[model samples]
Each structure stands twice: as C-alpha cells, then as structure tokens.
Target chain A: MSETIMLLCAIAGTYLWRALGVAFSARIEPDGALFRWVSCVSYAMLAALISRMTVLPLGSLAETPMSFRLGAMAVAIAVFLLARRGMFSGVIAGVGTFIALVAFA
Target chain B: MGQPNHPPGGRMTARAVVRLGLRRGVGLPSVIVMTSMMGFGSLAADGGISFLTALSASALVWGLPGQVAMAELWAAGANLLTVVLAASLANARFMPMAMSLFPLMRGGTRHRGAPYLLVQLLSVNTWAACQEIFPAIPLHLRVVYYTAFASTILVAGQIGTGLGFFAVAFLPKPVTLGLIFLNPCYFALLFAGTRVRPYVAALLLGAFFGPIIYALAPEWSLLLTGFVAGSAAFFFFDVRPTSVSNAESK
Candidate 1:
C-alpha cells in the first residue's frame, strides 16, 4: 500500500543522515568546511522551521489566533531569557501561557 | 566489580555512569520531549492517522517538525514522493546534529553497531544534553552516559507517543494549540539565548527571512531560507578578522 511505502520512505530518509554520521563519525572535525556547512545549514534550517512554525503553523495550530500564539511565545522568550536558556523551563512557561490564553481568553 | 579502563579521574563504574545518565535524562529533558511528542501524537490522531502510523513515525523519525510535516502532508493527501521529500527535508538538521555530537562522544565505536545505535538515540534534546554533560565526564564513561541518557529520552518519547495517541486522543483545540507551540518555543529560546556568534547571526537572519520567503514560496522556503541565512552567517563569521576571537587560542 501507499501508506506503508510512504512510512518506509520517511523512515529511511530521516535515518540516512544519522547512519551516515555514524559511519563517518570520528573522521569529521567540527570546524572543518563540510562540518561548518552542515552546522550552519542545521542552525539555519532549524531556525527557519521554528520561526515559521511559531509565526505560521499548520492544522489545529492554524486555528488558534495568532495573538495567542505570539503571547505564548513572548512568555516563553521571557522565561528562556530569565532561566538563561533552560529549555524545559521556557517550554513550560509557554505551554502554561498558551493554555491560559486558550482557556480563559 | 568491573573496571573499563576509565580516564584519569573516572571514579564511577559504568553502571553508575549509566544510572546517572538515565536519572538526569529522565528529569527535565525527558519531560520536554514527552510533552512535545505527546502533542505530536495527538496531532496525528486528530489528523485521522492510525495509531500504528503515528507510533512508527515518532519512533522512527524522532524529529517533531518532520513528524508534523509528514502527518500534515499525509492528511492533505499529498503524493508519496511529496511526503517523503518534505519529511526528509524537515529532518535535514539531524545530520549536523549527529555529526557535531559524535566527535564529542567517547568510545562509542568500540563494538559493532554501537556507533549506529548511539546515533539512533541522538535527538536534538539528547544531543544538546550530551554536549552539556560530555565535557564534564571522563572519556571512559562518556559513551556509557551518552547511550543511557539518549535511549532514556527516546524510550520516553515512545511512551509519550502512545499516551498521546490513546489516552489524550483528540486533544481539545486549546491544549492542542499549546502542545504544538512547545517544540518551536524551545528552539526559539535556544536562538534567543545562543552565545555563539554565527549561530546568533543565523538565527536572526533566518527569523527575519523565514516568514517572508514562506509567503513568497512555501514549497522551497525551508531550503532557501536555510541556505541563504546560514551561508550569510558562515561568511560573516569566516570573513571577519579574528584578532579578538580567532587570534587568541581556546
């Protein structure tokens, strides 16, 4: 079936790089050119995806008002800054704010 | 009773090291991933995906955005090829994540398939946590800790997926909204709190350009935005004279 095939492809595509990284693990220096490119691309790609998701998400998230999303993100940002990049603390704050906004507002 | 030839100060046994890794990972990092992954499961369920599909995707893919993309695209009735392409593109960052972390790990290549198995456990959360923990541990225990910690998180993720699929199935619009924001919020926080120069630059430029380009060309926006913003950041850092930074040794 198409569904099975799609899932297989998805799994393979995602795992390929991870497998390749293992294969070439000790050979690559973190600051080398290829590593730099991978690093830059990774950071850039993640940033773009995160920003886009926050700014313009899909599915049920698209249903929520952008104001609520922005407010939640602001709270998260404040928490992240205050906690000095403690990731869970920031996410916790954002989730709490987002729930409160959605429930009460 | 067993010694594994630890580095100069490796005072703990491998079992102790593994326990420490699992204990630390089970706390904050595991909780963060569970919430996000549980949300993904709920999202997938809400999108009409079957339980099996959702579970396999999370266990196999292990990336929130890619899982979301796959679920959403599948819901939209996208072709098989489109689904694979989009999902893989979303997963591209894991390559760098794996690459950067492997060199920092210790003795993972000692056994057959150990390195590959270790990489399988290395999510963004685990990778970040390892970077924080690896520098402090002796070389001998580093591999043990890394494996235990990452696998704990991954196991937690699988359980969360099941919880989201069955227990918290079809989350109400409000909680769904909140759960969806957690992953990106985590990353945005990382961006805001980053100390590295090029990464900070890339985050800024990527944030600036992501939405504009998404509107302009949604299909290729991720690749285009990353390539442009990342390249610009790389050049900005590379071309600058390192009198203050590079000239001095670490």
Candidate 2:
C-alpha cells in the first residue's frame, strides 16, 4: 500500500542523518564552533517543543485553561529550582500541579 | 591509545558487560526512558499497530519520537513520502547527538563495525547518559560498558513496548494521558537541566518563538520555529565565544 511505502520512506529518510552522523563522526568535533552552533539550535528546538506542548497544547490539554497550564509550569519551575533544578523534581511538580488543578477546577 | 579506549581484550563476558551498562544507567533517567517507551508503545498499539510491528519499529528505527511521528502520520493517512519526510525531520536532531558520543567511545583499534551496530541503539536518553558516564569509565572498558548499557535500555524499551501493546484494553484515561505526557515532560526537564548553556538559551528562545510561529503558520511551525530559534542561539554563540569557553572552564 501507499501508506506502507510512505512509512518505509520516512524511516529511511530519518535514518539517513543518523547514518551520516556516524559516518562523519571523526570529522565533526562537538567542542568546535560549528558544533556549538548546531548544539544551540538543537537546544532551542527542544525548548520550543516543550513550551509548545505545555503552553500552546493540542488535543486534550487544550480543554484545560491556559492560565492553569501556565500555573502548572510555574509551579514546576519553582519545584525544579527548589530541588536544585533536578529534572525528576520538575516533572513531578509540573504533572502533579496539572493533575491537582484539574481535580480542583 | 595504548590499551585501546574500550575493553582491551574485547572478550568480556556478556553478563559482566550488561552489568556494567546497568550500573552506568540505573537511575531516574533510565526509569524515565522505560516509562516513556511503555506509554509510546501502548499508544501505538491503541492506534491499531501490531505488537510485533511496534517492537520491530523500536528495534529498527530506535528513535521514539521519529517512530511515533511515523506511526501517527501513517495512521492519519498521510502519503508515504510525506510521513517519511516528517519522520526524517523529527530525527534530524539525532545526527549531532551521535556525532558527539561516537568519538568518546571509539577505541584505538576501533572496530568501525561496532558503532554501526550500536547506532541502532542510539537514542537521546542513552546518548545523554553515555556523555555523562564515558569519562569516568576506564578507557579500556568504555565500549563494553556502554554497549551493555545501550543494549539493556534497548531490551527494556522493547519489553515496555510489549507491555504497552498488550495492555491496551485495560489502560485508563488518566494513565493514557500520563503516557502521552511522558514524552514532553521528560524532554523539557532534560533540556532545561543540561549544563549546555547555549542549548538552554535555545530552549528559552525557541519556547517563545514556537507559538508565535505556529500562530502564523500551523503546518510548518515546527520546522520554522526550529530554524528561526536555533539560528538565533547559533548567532549568539558565534558572537560570544567567551561565554562558552568560560562555561567549559568551569
């Protein structure tokens, strides 16, 4: 089917970069300026993803008010910082806050 | 270079190697990976993908986000080429990641073939953990140690997917939501907590720009936001080399 072909194509296209990265591993140094730039870009892109999911959410979370979402994120940030900015603590705080806010509202 | 970077003999027992891997990765991070994969596998199953197919995808593709996008797009009836294109874009992030970790693990007599085999196991979770632990591991054992760790996570992920696939009937709404949420939550916290300051800056700027871009153009927002926000951080780092060197020094 066309769908199957598409899936295979997607998988191959994605793998191309992974394969390329491996092939050129020696040539690309992470500490160099170019790597640093890409790292920055990668980081920003990741950040955008997280923010989009929480702030501009889609599907189910969209029904949950934006203010509530911001509050959950704020509380999570607070917890993350309070726990010396540990990731586990931040995730717990954010999810916990969202669940509690939903329950109370 | 004298003893080679990985295990000198390349003959360590599989059990010892696996133990080293587990010891290296046993923590909240690995737990996060397992849980996220479980949720991902379950969602795929719920959407009507076969259990074998889901596991095979994980085994073959290995990048969960790419796999998820591929399956979701497929289910939504996107053209095959488009699905593949989108999946490749989603996975473009991994190129740098693999580039970062490979050198640290390559041995003096580095079997080029080994890394290719290991590439199948290369995901963000494993890469991050390897970066943190690679320096501390004895040079000679680094390969076996990392290979063990990578394989364990791979097996654990497969098992998690199997569970997700089979447990579709009984999963509750709260849990399903939790599973979907696992993907983003782990990503945000992990990025936010990294010592990579430029990346952190990227996240901050990208977060701000993502919605703005999305509002302007819904379909292309992800690509546009990534390029725009990433370019911003890239230019900033280019101009401010001192900031990066200072952070590295500390």
Candidate 2 lDDT, B152-178, residue by residue in tens: 777777877887777767976556555
Q: List chain A TM-scores, every candidate, in order.
A: 0.76, 0.75
- Show how many residue pairs clash in every candidate, following the order shown: 0, 7
C-alpha TM-scores of all predictions: 0.86, 0.79
- Output the number of the lDDT-best candidate: 1
lDDT at position B26, candidate 1:
94
Error of 1 at B191 (Å): 4.4
Judging by DockQ against the true structure, name the best candidate: 1
C-alpha RMSD values across all candidates? 4.2, 5.3
Q: Which CAPRI quality tier does the interface of model 1 achieve? A: medium
Give lDDT per model, in order. 0.77, 0.68
Off by over 4 Å in 1: A23-26, A31-37, A83-89, B1-13, B111-113, B168-170, B238-250
